[model samples]
Target chain A: MRAVLDEVRFLAFDVFGTVVDWRSSIARAAEPFLTGHGIEVDPLVFADEWRSRYQPSMEAVRTGVRPWVPLERLNRESLETVLARHGVDFGAVTGDELAELNRAWTRLDPWPDSVVGLTRLQRRFPIGPLSNGSIAGMLALARFGGLPWNVILGAEIAHNYKPMPQTYLRSVEAVGLRPDQVAMVAAHNADLRAARAVGLRTVFVARPLEFGPGQTADLTAEDDWDLVTGSITEVADLLGC
Target chain B: MRAVLDEVRFLAFDVFGTVVDWRSSIARAAEPFLTGHGIEVDPLVFADEWRSRYQPSMEAVRTGVRPWVPLERLNRESLETVLARHGVDFGAVTGDELAELNRAWTRLDPWPDSVVGLTRLQRRFPIGPLSNGSIAGMLALARFGGLPWNVILGAEIAHNYKPMPQTYLRSVEAVGLRPDQVAMVAAHNADLRAARAVGLRTVFVARPLEFGPGQTADLTAEDDWDLVTGSITEVADLLGC
Candidate 1:
């Protein structure tokens, strides 16, 4: 067992790229939608554009420009904007169809090591996702990907999005553990930095392909996190699971 | 699959009696403490009294007489009150010891059919506990009993107790489903009634021995629930899981 994890009672994860291959999954789901609409756009570019809207939308909540709505609503608004910007005709889509497509965030496929690693880690400590994704969205994603999170926590419960102090603080408190007793395992260095700033131990896992072949942002850790690994399974091994 | 369940995407459960045998579990844990303190009270009776305080304490939150606090704190306060009434000397116990004893709720054993039944049900629909237990308390109990809940909801999320409209409403909403799309499966008629009143469908499972040999309350369904069964396993069967 690593001495660092000796006091850790819970291992909280960042869901999007850390647990699920969001880019690829989103691209795959959007391809048929784009092709059926006769849009001459690469599905990967569409996925990138849709995901780029995530931060600005969440920023509206963090900055109090919007009230706390579940990420599902924000996701839909962002999706609609992206579709219109990309010249895709969503006029053919019913509200129900648009809503179903907005749930693409909940239909992600997990990175290969996520499920097995999380299962191993769960045997020794409570494991859960601390995503900016709404509790409902995470639950749907878990059901879809077989992610074994012990409890759902984060934005939905905190009423605040990620990189905000409340999101990390509230999640740790929800798990009934102090910040020092819970480790935040995330693929993004900025996320790890935010978590560490609030006294949580941070583990950095690399997902070079998280943003696809032309990925630029978060290509590698910007700082030395408490534990840096190539895969979540390595995280399990380090935790002595 | 039952046609009635065609729209239902989730089944939220009541944890204490409906999922775990809390009465027996509490009694078993308290017996040693009572015996060590030279108390003459029947442990089962003590368990009943402790459980009886549950609602009133929760009512304080529901009625806003008390600010939102986790059930674990309420449980400890209730335990101390019961201990004093029975003349159990706390002078012999340490603060740490009392806190440890307070977690008896987290150490509960599931009813024999709970794990198997929930496992089966989970294959078809997402299942979770919608208990007034604090999120931390429920998570610990789930780990202990090997209960498989897809998400954690209820009191911790709603910051309100059972029979309170928000508790049921928020749970259904938290599952990312409309009230009509999530069925509340419980052992108590009152719980089901509360759930149904909030537009959630209901399932009542009989647990005649929940309070041990002298159990009287909830011996049979008091109201017509959407589905009534004898065990959690039967609930799975009826749901075609």
Candidate 2:
């Protein structure tokens, strides 16, 4: 931890499942929107399907199979597909309404310790979200959830999504910090590994409930992270900020 | 103003002169850094020269004379040149120290009415700075001045500085609003003209003290702006939001 403090100047966060309870938040947001039309569907199943489509949709842009679209558009496209599969018709959902519902991703509830931990860490180092989400989406989430980020940065600025070196590099450059001076904090092993590969410090904060009840992975740190803590609060305590 | 209020969903602001007192802020920040070093340069002159270099430096990038560089880097390079010309030697200024000094742009003091005006406008529109400053720089200004911005959009994201259509378009796109749905509120006629060319609504808020007395321009609407108000508060009152 002292080693981390010595080198890390910026703390970049991974927003979705790492800092926020996306599964629960998405389910909660979608329930009312879905049930309002008398559409009877399992909200959890709907959320899982929504999450499932995220990667492939991003991959389409990453692989150049589709043009770069904002996360809101991609989410809406995926939502429509998922609802259609559940026998829900698009005739009831206008484009504007669908766009608003798709923005549910922007209002996810942070983990109980997330905001408090980030606020503490921010006192010592510049802290902001470094995620695959669009800057607009992240900003909306910050405003809605009161996430006190010094700045909001994401893949939209880099034109490349997470696990990509450009995504991490673009964030570091945006803050005028060297790669080695920025630390990537996340619950995802892949994200931390990518960040480390690009010469950034890494801190692992385990979110055991990240994947819901059936979660089997990411329950503990899988690699030698510079700092490992049970929660963002523990990480903040370890950092002594 | 009523016509604009009915359609405007986003408001992009110019940072330095429009929302903040840049000359005073820059002079104040540079004073302590330069004192007792046998470098008795006029802080006001330093501030003016520093700002004077901004447009030309950005023009170098815009015209392809220089590669794309963040505003912080541009500020550093220009600062070094300007200080050398002023016969001030700062052999003691380390790279880190110089970088921190460059961030003075981020911590500028807001205009007396900026905070109150922006707060009222934020209730009705998604308000943020649309400037040539970097995201980190704008975020710092917002935090230090208590500016309530829903997002911070800058040239770093657009890769083009203002007076360019991309700057205005990018701000609108970042907020998921069309050009016509956004309003560009600024003290500069050129900025408003650029925004107007792109179909954005425009409002001119006079900043008589922007140039610190003997100001010759931007004291009144130059073009047929959608709304002209004596101050940002007046603009807010006119918008009724």
Candidate 3:
């Protein structure tokens, strides 16, 4: 805690798996929609499949194989593909329905410690979500989860996704803080590595359930982060907040 | 009030005068700095002069007289000009000092009713500050004033100044709402008029002391805004929230 309090000023959090239980949220929300259409599918498998499309979709945009598209659009496209692969054809989904489905990302349930931990951290430092989601997405998620962020920041502001230096830098810029003054908090080693490479501090909070029961990776810290905490609340306590 | 409620799904607010009392906040903060330097100037006049530079600086960008510069840079440039005009040149003032002075915009005091009013409004509609300030500026102000904005939309995002249709439209787009579904709530008549011209709903909240005791303008509604009230709290009550 003293170590973190000594160096970190602003705490920038990765929104998806780090702060919110995205897999469960999506699975829960999609279950009703899928079941309502008389489709039989394993909700967890569906959640994992949906999340599996995320990296490839982002890679497509980054590699210029696809034009720059928002995460909502990518989610919808990938959702359709996943549903089709499962031998379930809901005919065609309307744009409005697609939009509502895409918003499942915004309605994610926060990990139990997220709200209380972030609220504690917010008392001492500027806190914001640094995610690949759009500003609108982060804002909605924050409102839904009561994730007391001082600001919403994401790829939409930078027009670049994470592991990209610009995404982290844009969050720092938005908070009017120097890169060194901001700390990136995430459960993923790659995110912390990227943040550290750009001179920002990093905190590792283990999210063992991020990928669910069969998760094999990101269960332990892979790099030397500024601080290691079991939960966001632990991070807040360590930071003396 | 009913008319505004019927069409408005989002409420965009003007920050400086509508949401926060910049004149008082700036004057209060600047007084200590000025006094420490043995520079006794009319703090109110100095604050007004500082604010008086805002629109023109933005106009310089809007009219293509200057390239798009962040609000911080614009404020710094205007501060130098204003200081020079006041004949109080502090040759020893460092860049850091000027930077701090520029950030006075971010620490403005909110009206007593702002937090409660905005929180109430946020229950039903997306609420944010749509100002000529930068995203960082708005975020910092929100933190300092405890303004409960769901999002921060500023000229930095729009790349344009108020009274321009793009400013209003960009804010609406950022919130994923149609123009008519958004309401521009401002103390300034010109802002509401511009927003209304772009097919947005409008609300006029009169800030009688915005310009201090001798000021004559913005004491009453100039246009037939969808809603008019003496305070933002009143406006919130009228909205039935």
Candidate topping TM-score: 1
For model 3, the stretches where C-alpha displacement exceeds 4 angstroms are: A2-5, A90-96, B36-40
Tell me the tens digit of each residue's lDDT in model 3 across A1-241.
Answer: 5454466668889989999999999999888777776667888888999999988878876666767666777888898888788776566556666667778988999999999999899988878888888777887788788877776776777777887888888778877778888889999999999999998988999999899988999999997788888899999888878
**Candidate 2 segments whose C-alpha is farther than 4 A from its true place:** A32-41, A63-67, A80-101, A119-125, B29-41, B80-103, B116-125, B143-146, B230-241
Give the lDDT ranking, best first.
1, 3, 2
Q: How well is candidate 3 docked (DockQ)?
A: 0.58
Best by DockQ: 1
Per-candidate DockQ versus the true complex?
Answer: 0.77, 0.45, 0.58
lDDT of 1: 0.89
Flag clash pairs in model 2: none
- Comparison by lDDT, 2 against 3, better one: 3
Per-residue CA lDDT of candidate 3, range B1-241, in tens? Answer: 5854586777889988998999999998788777766666888888999889888888888887887777888888899898878677668677777788878988998999999899888887778888988878887788788887777886866887887888888778776678989888999999899999999888999999999998899889997889989888998898888
lDDT of 2 by residue, A33-79 (tens): 88887777778877888898988878887777777777777887898
**Which CAPRI level is candidate 3?**
medium
Which of 2 and 3 is the better model by TM-score? 3
> What's the ranking of the predictions by DockQ, best on top?
1, 3, 2
